[model samples]
Target chain A: MNLQVSRFQFFSIVLNFIIYSSILMAPGITVINAKQDGWLSMLLALGVGLAANFLYLMLFKKHGYPSLFELMDRSAGKWIGTALNIVIVFYALHLTAMVVRNLSNFMITDVSPYSSPYIYQILILLVVAYTSYHGVKNLFLISELFTPFISLFVIGSLIVIIKHFKIIELKPFFYNPPSAILEGAYSTLGFPFIEIMLAGAFLTYVKRKDKLVSIALSAIAIGGAVLVITVILVIGNDSAYIVARESYPTYSVMRDVSLTTTFKRVEIIIGIAWIIGLFFKISTCFCVAMMGIKHLSKSKTFRGYIVPCAILVWAMSNGLHKTFIDFTNFVSMDWTLYWFTLYSFVIITMLIGLARKRA
Target chain B: MQDWKTTMKANKTTREKIVLAIVWGFSLYYIIGYLAGIDPFPITVWLKAIYGPIYHTLFGG
Candidate 1:
């Protein structure tokens, strides 16, 4: 069966893919690193992310490959291409596991500290795996349907919290040493920004390719602007120290809003929005992993592998880190660098393919 | 050179089954071990070891 997504749906998918996970912890990570100037760091990361994406798209277009896997196959030869595909499949699965763990950790610490994270893990995996099994349309459709509400949640928080903004909180602009600001940008870069390369998996399935590069970049720009605004709001509401210390600063921002005597529980909406965001995130990664399997095995459908995929993702997520500290530590400090390994793989393959002039 | 796609097409079921068995085996080991509270083989130990030098170098812990 052929599957295709419209440009608008693809835009929504890319937007949610970037926003959901990043918004929750990125503010705290950036604030902790760049302090009050964290927004600058975030802006810097977004700028770099966009430019990298532009270059990636242009190179792949020039290479004339429908997919990165195809590019690798023609460039590196058969055995090596299969190996690269397997490595990427593992990477996507690892991402699914890590994202699930992120959700479960959030639930335990913030939503219900008394609840077992394993419960959330199982519950979420059931939905995610099932959505992934139905194939890409179902997954992307879910994201397209819910994109507006998530956007509104962000916008509504901004509107309601404007009264609380302390313009002074954004002071001492650029006070952070360039290295510190760059460090903040570097951490955020590897995450939601650079990870956009995952879009390569779905590129061939997109109905519109001519403007796809611009559409994707625009979607990312919007996502980045949201992150920057979130930092401003988060820092404006509380001191940088406090915002930095909060595990989920954007959640904290929504949780702390008090417009009236009893109308301040915007956090419920934020929580629901984040859950949907995570659903898209995990489901997208799961589907990509499945797609990689499809490409690698040359299989007709990836349906039969869904059960194992869910089981492995569950186990890997549980076994990924010993504690929440390890999880957050790796994510905050080293995730970008770890994820860069995939980029390094792609660059090597692309160079070899170009040198061979297969096109 | 055996074309990988052609090779995969010829043995798709076998290839998929091998992939499934491998995933199940690896994950089930962790699942059973973690549930039994034994964790005979912890992947984190290896992962952290690999990422340790990189993390320290990048963030300077």
Candidate 2:
């Protein structure tokens, strides 16, 4: 289709990716590790994430707007490039599966237990596949249309939960052990930040290379700051013990809001926000993955692969089973380390190789 | 390797069209399943089987 997306659309997609996945559960997980100083840990993680973002920017600048696949082929050999492509494709597929499973679990447990996770996963994947199959343009347009509502929902959640924010709850914010802070930072950096590496694939399509670095940096900064504030507010509003034990602490904070006793249980609003943002996130990732597959296979019609890929993703997710705790532990422990190290190495190595070639 | 421009110009045949239609039909199974509340059994079982092994390998219970 020779579809080209605008910079604003790209920016909105990036914003959606950054905000959706981490906000809902980060408060709960970070507090479990960092206690009263969870927000500080998030800030530290933000600093690390920003540095990584700059590193990715440097790689992009050196390559002069090459897509991730092209850059890998240029800097590394064709075989190595193909190997890396396989790895990235699998990594992205796994991520999409994780997200689907997580969202399905949340919806099934909280919203409607009668609803089957299988149904939710398949339906959502179809929507994602359809949007992605139409190409990046459709995905970007959807993000643009949904961005405002997602933003308002997030901001509104913050406002509604603000009444419970107490200075006393934030006291002794630096009380956590250094190990706890380190663990929290490591997990966060591994997750939402390092996952930004996947964005490199889409950089080739960005029309404005001049502003790409700045916009990318801004996404990390703004997204990280929002997460930090959310963590702080969650910690301030809820007890550390409660926050740690809760599955969706921010949603719990939303539930606690009741302005006139009539506006009770407003957590559904937060669910709507997460769903919108998460939908865009998954759709964008699916778009990039499909694009990469097309580029690799030299396919004319990318839509041909959508059903197979979606089926693969649905299977990958459904295999994870009924235990959220097991999934949580895997994400927090194993996946975090693997992704953070792998992405950091890829970006750094690509930058060095590209720079040397340029020099 | 053929150039991307030329590659994209290649037209889809009737078989490809038929295949695409069938794929779309399978994809829509989910929509109908959700709305009708019918269980699509063997596919769901297959998914669970694939996911279970991978999750176990990744997390190691």
Candidate 3:
């Protein structure tokens, strides 16, 4: 199968992957942890996230196509390699389930309280399954087309609400305890950022392997800036207390914007951009999981596994949490450590492979 | 019965066939269960069933 994607398409995929669900929810977690210094926390997290990306790039340079799975195989023999592959596949599926659940919860809580969560759950899973069946080329084709509109609407919303931004909301910047900033950084690093580990699964398919590092770095930097600006805007407009209290601070801040006396409730723009971004996000995560399954099982075709995988993701999404609070608490408290542990495993495996190459 | 069993064995590797059967079988079972409005087995059951004792022994969670 021709899975090759261009530099621009790959960039769009990575950018959409980072911003999709994070824009809606990350600011709240940042504010809750770092208070007025939430932007700084994101900055710190971005630096750490970039360093992780550098590690991925190093692995890619050494072991080109097939990415992390190949690196694991080279680092360890067949038995251990297959075992690690299973673990990586599980992690990808878990992350995909979390994303699916996050979007489902957003719709239930903010968009439609009366609707059954299963409706959105099945609908999204069907869409994701269909996209994954067609493979990465078609997936990122939609990403490349929709990415512009998502970016335009996001930037437009920021401009519309530009006047409401207040300096006072960020006054006590350094006042947060060191632990708060560190926790916030850790959480941000785990989410939306280090989660680019999913993108590593696709790096092999990039037609211009030479541009991989630059493109990935640029995407991360752009995504980080958008996140920082989002934090600033959310805290600036609504105050850190309001941003922290709200379930979706970025969306809530957009809700408060009014372009003119006659115009109101412009948060709808934010919703439109976010929903579009999430389509690509969910698709990317599902694709990564599909890739993992193919590699682990040595399957010639991924299509056969798509339906079963989507069903498993849907089941996990539904069964995982009873309420949104539990979900967010998991994200803030445990998710970072869980995510970093998996990432560190991959990096360690790669480092071992690199050392052996030299030896 | 002997002919059918011979044919099945000739068509695929045992591992491939087993994986296929598991995938399709579990998928169909889950679909039927979902349509019938059967709640999924509680997530915590497995988490606790498996991880609970591990955590208790390792970190005493």
Using lDDT as the measure, the top candidate is 1
Worst window of 10 by summed lDDT in candidate 1 chain A: A63-72
Model 2's CAPRI class is incorrect
lDDT of each: 0.83, 0.76, 0.80
For every prediction, compared with the true complex, DockQ reads 0.37, 0.08, 0.23
The docking quality of candidate 1, as DockQ, is: 0.37
Task: Report how far off residue A235 is in candidate 2 (Å).
Answer: 0.9
Please provide, for model 2 over A236-344, each residue's C-alpha lDDT reduced to its tens digit, 9 standing for 90 to 100: 8997778999888888788778767677788888899998878877876777677766666655667877877797678657654337886776666656656765686
How large an RMSD does model 1 have? 4.5
> Candidate 1 has which clashing residue pairs, if any?
none
Minimum summed lDDT over a 10-residue window in model 3 chain A is located at A62-71
What is the Å distance of residue B31 in model 1 from its true position? 2.4
Q: Candidate 3 on A232-336: residue-level lDDT in tens? A: 888889998888899988887887778888888888888878877877888887888777767766766678789888888887786566678877867766666
What is the alpha-carbon interface RMSD for each candidate?
Answer: 2.3, 7.5, 4.3
TM-score (chain B) for candidate 1 is 0.51
Task: Give TM per candidate.
Answer: 0.92, 0.85, 0.89
Record all residue pairs in model 3 with backbone atoms less than 3 Å apart, i.e. clashing: none
Encode model 3's per-residue lDDT on B2-25: one tens digit a residue: 999897558656666666676667
